[model samples]
Target: MTALERIAEWVTSNPPVTAARRAAATDAFVDTLACMVAGASDVSTLGAIAVASHADPRESAMCVDGAMRAPSSAALINGTAAHALDLDDNFIGAATHASAVLVPALLAAARQAGADGAALLDSYLVGLQVQREIGREIAAKHYTAGWHATSTIGQIGGAAAVAHLLGLDATRIVAAMSVAVSTASGLKWQFGTPVKPVHAGFAARSSVEAALFAQAGVAGRSDVLEGERGFAALYGAPHADWPTAPIDTSVAHAIEQPGLFPKLYPCCGSTHLAIDAVLDLLREHSFAAADVAEIVVTVLRPNAANLPYTHPENPTQARFSMQYALISALESGTVSMADFEPATVRERRTHPLLDRISVRTWSEKAERIMLDQGRTPHRVELTLTNGRKLDRQREVARGAVSEPFAPWEKRRKFTSLSGLSDAHYDAALRLAASPNIDAIERLLAAAIRLRNGAGE
Candidate 1:
């Protein structure tokens, strides 16, 4: 069977979850909804999508805080919005933004099919579990070698969610899985452009199309994932021993034991550890930007070893640039939405900071220590003119596996992004904790109120 077939069969056979599991899924779904509201009005590609989506509106699924749209359009908008802040949770090992990408796609499918909140939550959790497994397996090769794990692995998550919502039999789920193979795409090379969110938009739209096609009995190659020219071989170099492991296509539970980590920072997951380390130093020691002579950051060779970023020319690229972000944090005290703008792209203040900051391979002991904790740790050393030296070592970045952001912190982030007032933020946080998608819809409407003049 194709790799896709294996996952589909598993989704079909997975048993009902306990109440606790369902509640956990509900929690994650609400977080994604908050992510959508926070990002909906971002001067991101999502806002433009919101505009374009309204052009051919259909009553399939809800937009951030507005009228219904065609299922495909709704998925696109929500997917875009969820990823708008670039602040969504990451599938840590896989490096894909888990909740933003997966939750939005699932919401679009669930709303279109008129599935209840309970069913929607179940499907969301199942889809995440499947995505995690796929990411764990595939990214050992594909993502490490440079493909964007988001598009490559996101298709499976999107497909799994649709299969659950549509009540597709194992056979049809397999069909959707195979057909989705043709739709899987996205690359790491496009990180800094408007095209990044478009990647999520396309994943959402194509999954809906794939599910509909499968519903129509459209056939596809069975082993699309394992075939000679299939996903494994074509996307990136596969791990040499992955073919030898006899994967049992029979997992019944979708939620991993601990569930996924919601993010605290708004940059590439790989950079979170370093950002956290640096921020802590600034906050703890209160380092003044003017006092620093040189800043050296120790990062994993694997994350940016082959990454050839000469200088970031845009905000999207800036998100992935450890040099740019650290530099911005040094000069600006914090990295905000404005740091991603075109005006700051090549500005002297930002660029000079980049020169002061240099990245080198982390020591073997450091790498082993951080990885053991399921987070990347960074060691930063800054030399000051007054003969003062500051050293900061972080085992994990903030908003990640270690040093996570709290609920209130996330709400503040949403309030800033969506321009929601304190009252609206409180309500949205409640929506995040609730199971009602309508409450989420209400939160979104309030978000739109904040979007009027906040042009991306």
Candidate 2:
């Protein structure tokens, strides 16, 4: 069987997802919901919501405004909002924001199909496994080649999730995957623009449409993933390997392994390890930001390539700049969403720190070693005016699987970002664990009410 066929079969089958895996999936979902609520008012998200509101209207929930829209429109708006702040969960192996794409698409499709919460969570688990596996097969070359995996590889995963929600058999699921493969398109060059969040929106919308089209008897080539001119051949590296059979998830799902890396800061994941390293050093040594004469950060070559801006002109670009992330953490002792605001990014105090910071690419040997260990490594060094150099190296960031957020910590983060009361936060956690479609609607309604009253 072809790669797409195998993937479709796996997605349609019932994989044994452990309780721990289910809990992790719930955490990812809750995190994505918090991100959506927090980014609801962002310019990019608002603009996409406006556009989607004008499109065909169907009955589905809009996480931000609590409005009902068509499935595609709902996916478009919610997906865009989820990624607007760049705080959504990411899959390091896939080099993509998995929940940002999967949550919105699956939720929309589920609402349309009247699928229960259990089905939604199960589909998400299966789709996430497929996305990361495909990423492994393509290796890091797909990302290094300038393709935005969130939309490219994510499109396939989104389709799988939607297909499962729609109860499509293996044959129809293959058609959906084929349609997704044909529609996949995104570029990494758009990283610092409003269009970056829109990429997630497009992936969610396209996947929903692909699955719906296949359910309506639309057909596509089953071998679209591994064919001669297929996704791997044209979009991935020339030497990429295509797996003949799907990786078995019956014993353990991918969500239990490397899993999802939820963001602690509202910046690019590439800058996270360096930010953590700097914060670690700051906590160990007592020194003001002004006491540091110079700072240097070293990271894997791929991360360095992702963060190209030395001095960002705006908040959007700041999210992709290692200099901004590191210096902001140093000055404030923490990096929060407020630090990435336009006014904050333009602060004169930060300019001095930015001038003192420099980002360097790690050695080829170091990069290979880190990759082999399945790690994203970073090192931070500070040269004090007294000629003392303090340094720290981190193999992984805080929210990664190696050092995941505790239950209370994640709850605090959700409340902080969503601006919801503790009661609402608890309600969300309960709903995430039990997931009925009707309960989801009520949860969103309650959140909207709280947000309006809080004037957030």
Q: Give the number of the best model, judged by lDDT.
A: 2
- Which residue segments of model 2 deviate by more than 4 Å? 55-57, 432-435, 450-456
TM-score of 1: 0.84
- Those runs of model 1 whose alpha carbons end farther than 4 Å from true positions after fitting are 16-20, 41-58, 65-67, 237-259, 305-311, 341-351, 362-375, 387-389, 421-436, 453-456
Q: How many clashes (backbone N, Cα, C below 3 Å) per candidate? A: 5, 2
> In model 2, what is the error at residue 4, expressed in angstroms?
0.9
- Per-residue CA lDDT of model 2 for 327-436, tens digit only, reads 78877898898898778888833477778888887777877787777776788888999999998888888988879888898999888887766776666556545546
Report, for every candidate in turn, its global Cα lDDT versus the true structure: 0.67, 0.82
Clashing pairs in 2: 58-70, 117-435
**Candidate 2 structure, TM-score to reference:** 0.95
Where does candidate 1 clash, by residue pair?
2-223, 43-456, 192-316, 192-317, 264-399
lDDT of 1 by residue, 79-135 (tens): 777777677776654556666666767767766666767777777766676676666
